[model samples]
Target: MNHNQQSTDGIHEDDAALSEFLASLMDYTPTIPDELVEHYLAKSGFQCPDVRLIRLVAVATQKFVAEVATDALQQCKARQTTVVKDKRDKQQKYGVNVKHQEYFADSPSTGMDPASRDE
Candidate 1:
């Protein structure tokens, strides 16, 4: 679908594109044009331009934080699924963790008993 198309949820594809663009802007200088800034300032009904800009930045920051939090939760869910009975299965499915092999051990009891080992 094109950017102008409206989805079942009533949000236009352009809205999503705009949101993505704005999120990317947060990563750089966020050099919004003065005319666009003035437009938003006027639409916001705020008398002071400084306060309007502050509120706009605050909203953008909040949106970015929420998106990051949601992504983290999704990653946690995917990681949780890697929990299986066999170590080889987990390794085969999720690959080995060379940095921390113990984290993906097939069995927690697989660790050697230091007490039983004769020094």
Candidate 2:
């Protein structure tokens, strides 16, 4: 097929898919209620007589909110993980230093006997 014909076919396919999607919206209930969406839309001075369009808007809003909430949760979890890792690193460093100090304080080469040091 010619390039122009191919482009025309693609547009027709897209239109068919869009129509199918809008029809499917009627069967699906969004997390955000239709009444709530209508109320807010009316408040915002937006008017649409089509229920499918309202449902589409509601589904889109629900998806946007869910994505934002998920991102925030992920960031919170990542920050918590970072904090736990830092605490563990600090404890490991301090524990190693404490062990080294104890080893040196009791070593015979340091000219200090363990019993004398304890006293």
Candidate 3:
């Protein structure tokens, strides 16, 4: 096929896919209610009488919120994992030294009471 024919075919395929997606949107119910979407749209001074367009807006908003929530959850989990890892690393690196210091500080051989050391 010529380059022009190939480009034309690609455009047709894209149009078909977009039509299919729009058709599917008719049957798909978004998590965000249509009433809420319509109310918000109306409040924002946007007027659309078509139910399909409202539904499309609702679906898009739902998808955007879901994506943002998923990203936030992933970031929270990653931050928690990093915090836990850092704590474990610090403990592993200093656990023995801390314990040893406590032991020696309280030892009778030191002849210095732990409470007096603070003075």
Candidate 4:
């Protein structure tokens, strides 16, 4: 493989694409029961634990970590988009003024303005 070559044997066009595909492959969660387990074991060459408890724990750990990583990526992307939009608005000098906030709620106002609220 030449250094100047655009294409490689294993690598695709962009690294991000390959990484995302690998991430998705690792993120698969299946409800494999005892019957399914026996079937898979007979088909595959690798050795798996006979203990049902350990298999369940492995499945749960894989699922939890994948979900957490995917969620973190999504949150980061959303925040990045918001920051980009804010930066664009600032550049434009729009008449509407809004401040960035992390209310942990859908709406910062939450249907009740502090100035107008009785409580």
Candidate 5:
């Protein structure tokens, strides 16, 4: 194979392109959710297990993390937007600065106990 020849991929990547790709990979960190981690661990089906098995699970999960994260982000945004919309709807329905008297119910003590005072 010639040094400057185009590889099977069809595009001839120079050293700079390869270097840039490698550099980008260095900064690439997959954001896997805790739920996925738990699911993977549970699917492995073991107590105090082998390191190789753990590594295998991690490697397998790495491929799906990007897709999972993208979907999770979309769901999160939808949930948050719904919550905000619900809050606004409630506020509008009840009127602005609405305060329930039950929330400010009478308390037993103001600050200190009655017997503790040096009166």
Candidate 6:
């Protein structure tokens, strides 16, 4: 599943996390050198070295994204076992709400009853 060039399983949800991913790209994978990458950028009239780093980083990033995505998929599938569910049955799962939910008791049966809604 380590198809780095593929689109579906290729990328990670967080693109920013890729640069810090394990293993260097140029060292492990086929890619341009950092110096050459900068050369191309400079030849193209780009001034910032950081911008060049961005390009090299993309390749460096692929390895981690692949590793993470595969691990995540495996973990999720592993959680699907009946044994896991049996254990979870005794555990109460809590749902978090980021937004307030409106509540009312015996509030109304319709948008408005003219008599009841009138101030």
Using TM-score as the measure, which candidate wins?
2
TM-score order of candidates, top first: 2, 3, 4, 1, 5, 6
**Candidate 3: what lDDT?**
0.88
lDDT by residue for model 3 (1-119), tens? 69999999999999999888888888988889999999999999999988788999998898899999999999999999999999999988876554443444445447767688677
* Model 6 regions more than 4 Å off: 1-55, 82-119
Report residue 65 deviation for candidate 1 (angstroms).
0.5
Clashes of each: 1, 0, 0, 0, 0, 0
Clashing pairs in model 1? 87-106
Error of 1 at 15 (Å): 16
- What's the CA error at residue 76 for candidate 6, in Å? 0.5
Across 1-119, the per-residue lDDT of candidate 4 in tens digits comes to 47646566336657777566546544444455445555565576545554443345446655787999999999999999999999998889966658776557666566787786555
TM-score of 5: 0.31
Writing each residue's lDDT as its tens digit, candidate 2 over 1-119 gives 69999999999999999999999999999989999999999999999989999999999999899999999999999999999999999998866444443444445546767677677
Which candidate should be chosen as best, given lDDT against the real structure? 2
| Residue 84 Cα positional deviation in candidate 1, in Å, after optimal superposition | 3.8
TM-score, one value per model: 0.32, 0.76, 0.68, 0.37, 0.31, 0.27
Tens-digit per-residue lDDT, 1-119, candidate 1: 65445453356566887677666654544334445655666688855545345445656766787899999999988777665446668667897557854466666555669675443
Candidate 5: tens digits of C-alpha lDDT, residues 4-118: 4557344545666756654554444434543455566777775434433444444457767767989999999999999999999998897766666554425645455778654
Give candidate 1's total backbone clashes: 1
TM-score, candidate number 2: 0.76
Q: Tell me the TM-score of model 6.
A: 0.27
Candidate 6, poorest ten consecutive residues by summed lDDT: 21-30
Position 12, candidate 2: lDDT: 100
